[model samples]
Every structure is written in structure tokens, then in C-alpha cells.
Target: MHLIELSIAKFEENLCRLKASETVCSSSFSSISQKLTRLQDLHECVENFLLLPLTQQALAQECGDKWINELLDGSLRLLDVCGIIKDALLQTKECTHELQSIMRRRRGGDMSFISEVRKYLTSRKDVKKAMNNALKVRESNCTDKNHETPAVVNMLKELDAVTIAVFESLLSFIAGSKSKSSSWAFVSKLVQPKRIACKGEEVANTNELEKVDAALQSLVSHKSKKSDNTIQVEDVQIWLQDLEANIQDIEEGLECLLRRLIKTRVSLLNIFSH
Candidate 1:
């Protein structure tokens, strides 16, 4: 194999290495730290390959070889991976903050948090619509040349499914929150705002109240188990925390899938380099 082919092979190896790093780091408590270190290593590996002397000569060749062009294309794709990793890092941090905010607000007795949750839930429709449109466009744009097509399609599908699930969880959390929120107003004869004024809120809160007894049977695994007399703020807090955690996890998986797609495409370009 020529110097160019050898370099392309090295690039493919790094692609595999990047995926392997994710698998290794996923099982650990320090996943965030491990991911960052692995990502930095990936950046260095690709950067070094791109800056090699022979690789430069190959790109600068007078003959305009097809292999050289493929190498350039693959390298460009790797640069796109760089942008992806950077954005993923920012998103991971954002998700963490969002998760903590949910926990903090619940402890501080923030009712407005429910309003925010509802707003985001409503926005899910727009998000799904936009994602559907993007998926259609991506499917139409797929060509045999793009080796990342399968992974891209899988990523989009998983994202759509996860988004729907998260939306439903948020709705459930809102319902649970209302139940706990309304437990204080005890005058059953008087029309409660949540119990009667708002149809959606009424069902969510009332239904939750009805299930409080049954729910306790399953709460033995939790740290604090409360009796059926009260709707425990901790119950709502746990529900919200679970929903937030799901969103954070989905974001991470999507980000990783994207990086994998980019890497697969880079490797394909290398194979086609010959």
C-alpha cells in the first residue's frame, strides 16, 4: 500500500478507536470525564494524520489523483466530526444544568416549574414536526456515496422515539405535580381550581390522588416511603427527576450516534480512496 492508503487505514483505525472509547466509558461513574479525555485523544489523532508531510504532498500532487480527492473529502468529514463533538460537549453540560434545575426548583416550592414543563411539552409537537421534515429530506438526499446513511437514519428514528417518550413523561410529571399541588386545598365541597376549573388539571391531580395508595406498594425501593394521607412532594420530585434524566441520556446517545455516523463515512471514503 502507498503512503496515502496507509494514512487512510490509520484514519479508519481511529474511527474504530473512537467508537471503542464510548463503549468503555459508558459503564463507569466517571463517564463524563472519560468521554472528554477520549474525545481529546480522537481530536489529536485525526489532526496529526491530516498534518502529515506525505498526506500534504498527496493532496498537492499535480496528477489530480482520485485517491487524493477521496482523502481530502474524508478529512473534511472528520472536521465535521470535530464540530459535532464540540456541540455534544455543550449539550451534555446543558442537560446536566437542566436536570439540577428541576431538582432545585422542586425543593424551593416553585410552582412555575410546572408551567415551564407544560410549555416545553406543548413545544414537543413543533419539534416532532421539524424532525419529521428533516428526516424526509435526509431520506431523499441519501446516495450510495454516503456510507453514514444507515447510522444517520437510525439516529433520527431513535431521537424521534425518545423525544415522544420524553414528552409523555413530562405530561405525566405535570399531572403528578398538580396532584401534589392541590392536596393542600381540603374543602371537598368547594370547587377547587385544579379539581374543577381546569379539565386537564382536574383529571391529572384527581387521578393521581386515587392512585396514591396503590403507588406506595411500589415505593419500598425508594429512600422515603410516605403514607396515603398526603401526596408527598418527593413523589413529584422523583417523577420529574426521572424525566429529566431520560432527556439527558437521550441527548448523549444521539450525540454519540452522530459521531459514529461521521466516522463510518470517513472510513468509507478511505476504502473508496483506492
Candidate 2:
């Protein structure tokens, strides 16, 4: 029991640190990727905590409780969200790769570039829609403030909430800005005389994903202009490569966390089955 308490305390401390970090540096590709890595570490700790003999005994005693059922349901939902994000990442990567290939080949001229750019934009919209649907799900709260829950149950509830919160952040990052403001509107800010005069450093700090988005919007809007003139094809390609690399890193982290989640779920099932 003492060891179990220590484990729970350590997990809570780490969770608090992650939440604090989120507030300070909410949404950059590097920050999101780092968050994913930290999440993977936290889930591994959870899996170890669940494997403790004391934890198994306690959970077994509470086998038929509502909280146990809630945990099981929450695990399934987490898995579902993981699957959706992984698929979205993969689709985006493939689309980006196709665009890069088209740019390199420059085979069919402006029409080909325009067709592929449109396809990539359409892909982004589809991914955003899927992420939004995933976000709409209201998770079951097993932690009741009015009713006193057991320590193990409370710890698990907090863990579930934190895990879901991290996933929500990741999903939102992938979905990009939801504001109706046009990508053109954003690009204009970059090139407008006032912005060009005053915003040198700030513009450089924008993420590769947004940079590519704005460049693509410019290309599509000015189809008659030479693509290189509208937005250097070379610059867009570099941004796409950077985006691809970051997405790949996130995907690897997600895969590891998904495995850890599965292990934790299986451990819970075994406890309840006994």
C-alpha cells in the first residue's frame, strides 16, 4: 500500500508538470511532439502501476463497481481516438508526399500543380472534420465529487482525464485554426506592407504546417501567376518536408502510447476477470 501510494504520487506530480507546460507553450510542432513523448512516458508509468500486485488485488475486489465499468469504457474510447489520429496522420503524410512528388516532377505544368494542391487542401479538410467528430465525444466521468471514491478509483479517474486532455490538444493542433478567417487573410498579414515592415521575426516563427498552408492558398488563388513567383515552389517543398518529419515523429510516439494503453487495459481486464 505504501509503494502504491508513492507510485500514485509520482504519477500525479508528473501530470501536474505536463499540465503546467501546456499552459506555458501550448501549440508548436516541437511542443506538441514533446508533449506526445511525455505522454508516452506517463502511460508507461501507468502500465507499471497497474501491474503491481497490490493494484491488481484492490481492483479485483472492486470488479463489479461502476468505476470499473467506466474505466473499461474509457479505455475503449481512448483506443478509438488513437486510431482516428493515427489514420489522420497517415493520410496527411501521403497527401504531402504526393504534393512533393508533383512539385519535383513538374510534369503536367501549372494545371498539375493546381490539381495536386487542391487535393492536399481537400485532404486537410477531411482530416479536420474527422478530428472534430472525435472531439465531440463526451467522456464518461467516473470521478464523482459528491460520492467518495476509493483511492485507486480516484487515481485512475485522474489518469483517464489527463490522457484524454492530451489527446484533445493533439487533435486540435492537427485540425488547425477553426476561425473562419481565410488562409489568404493570414497570408496577407505576412506580405502586407505594414507586416513586412514590422513583423520579420514573428513571421519566421510560424510553424511549417501553417507556412505550407498559406503558400498553397496563395498558389491556388493566383493560378495565372508563375507558381514560383506566387510562392517559391522550393520554399513550399522545404516546409512540406519539415511538416512530414514532425508528423512522423508524432506518429511514432502515438504508436508507442497506444501499445501501452492496450497493456493497461488488458491488465485491468485480467483483474476483473479473476
Candidate 3:
């Protein structure tokens, strides 16, 4: 039997098993059975087309074209599934934020409520896996090598942007609201000053370092003058550290992307040159 026919048979068998289960209601089982029957009808239609003579080249081509279209539709559906998973992750982040707000408002600071939210966060592993699997399916569908299509490249870039946006939004939300100092404090450590090279030579200007220090000091002095309730000096230091670290990471990622783009452009030029 053809692959579609086999799949239809398996679906029908599963539907039968589901219907036989004592736990399932009659109405639900009937609905599923009807859907399976429709799928079986589709399978029969495809089987009829396949049974036609090889001399009917146009009909064979039409069947092949329809099959390819169905494959593309399935792949697009996988992409939509990934989007749904991403939205679910965002909802989880929102729930975490709301829980944090509730904790802050409550006098006793209920630990159990926060714990429940953390548990929900932990349950996101399956959703993450589903998203990754969908991404893999989408990537596998793009087999063209000679011509680089905008759709393929844009899809990848959009996926990357969504991921980065989600992470950054979650981090910012947690940092701003959560009272659990450990979480934000750990992130602060990630933002610590590291030796970075701008040009070929190492930065040796004591004056430039002094200028940066002076600017930070001036900002602190201004804030202290303006507001009676200012953030703690330690917190300010940590925030600055984290900001620097994030800037470094962004710069590195940009450089890597630029290099890849340049390489692809060079390859394309060589292809045209030939």
C-alpha cells in the first residue's frame, strides 16, 4: 500500500481503539470516527489517482504536484505550531510576573504561591521541545542550494529575533519586579566588566577610563540630589555591570551575523562570476 493509505489505515485503527475505550464518551468517539472516515475517503481518492496507467503522464504529474503541495502545507502547519508554543511561553512569563506582583502586594509574602508559579515554569520543557522540533521541520523543507530565497532567510532571522526578544523581556521583567535578590544578582554578575578590544591595540587610556568613572559618579550624584529614595549604591553598580555585559554580547552577536552575511554575499558573487 502507498504511504498515505497506510497512514489512513493506522489513523482508522487508532480511532477504533479510542472508540472502544470505556472512558471515552459516545459523542466524542463518534466525532473522531467521522474525522477518520473523511481521511479514509481522501486516501481512497489518492489511491484511485495512483492506480491510473503510466501513459497518463499529465495525471501522474498532477498527483505529484498535489502531494508536494500537501507536504508544504504540513510544513507550514509545523511552523504555526512553533508560533503557538512561543505564545504559550510568553503567557507563562506573564503568569510569572503576575505571581511576583501578587507576592509583593501580600503582607506575609506567600512562598507557596510563588512555588506554584515556578512549577508551571518547569512544565515548559515539553513546549520548548515542540518548538525546536517544528523549527527543525521547517529547516528541513528548505532544500534549495543554488538560489537563496528571501523567505527562508527571513524566517530564520524572525525566529532569532523572537527568541532574543522573549529572553530579554523575561529578564527585564524579572529584574524589575522580583524581590528574590539571587535571580537578579546572578544576572548582575553576568554583566561584569570584561577586557574588550575595540581596535587592534589594547585600550591604554587612563583618561578615558577616568572619564567613564566620572560620568557614572556624576549620574549617581545627580540622582541623589533629585530623589530622597534612590536605589542602593550596590544595586546601581550591579545594574551598570549588567548593562555593560549585555552591550558586549550584542556587539559580538552583530559581528558574527555581519561576517556570515559577508561570506554569503561573496559566495553569491563568485557564483555569478563563473
lDDT of each: 0.39, 0.78, 0.35
lDDT of 3: 0.35
Index of the highest-lDDT prediction: 2
Per-prediction TM-score, please? 0.37, 0.89, 0.29
What is candidate 1's CA lDDT for residue 179? 41
**Residue 138, candidate 2: alpha-carbon lDDT:** 52
How many residue pairs clash in each candidate at the backbone level? Answer: 0, 0, 0
Residue range 1-274, candidate 3, lDDT tens digits:
2543454354445434433442333222123223333333333333333333431232233334443343334334433443454354354444434544544554222455435434434443444444454444443233332233233222223223333333233223222222334333333332233422231123221112122223233332342333433333343344334334433433343334334333333432332233
In model 2, which residue pairs have backbone atoms overlapping below 3 Å? Answer: none
Clashes of 3: 0
Candidate 2 C-alpha lDDT tens digits along 94-168:
999999999998843489888999999899989988988888875655445334566777777777787888889
Name the lDDT value of residue 131 in candidate 1: 37
Better of 1 and 3 by lDDT: 1
Instruction: Give the Å error, residue 76, model 2.
Output: 0.7
Error of 3 at 134 (Å): 3.5
Q: How would the candidate models be sorted by TM-score, starting from the highest?
A: 2, 1, 3
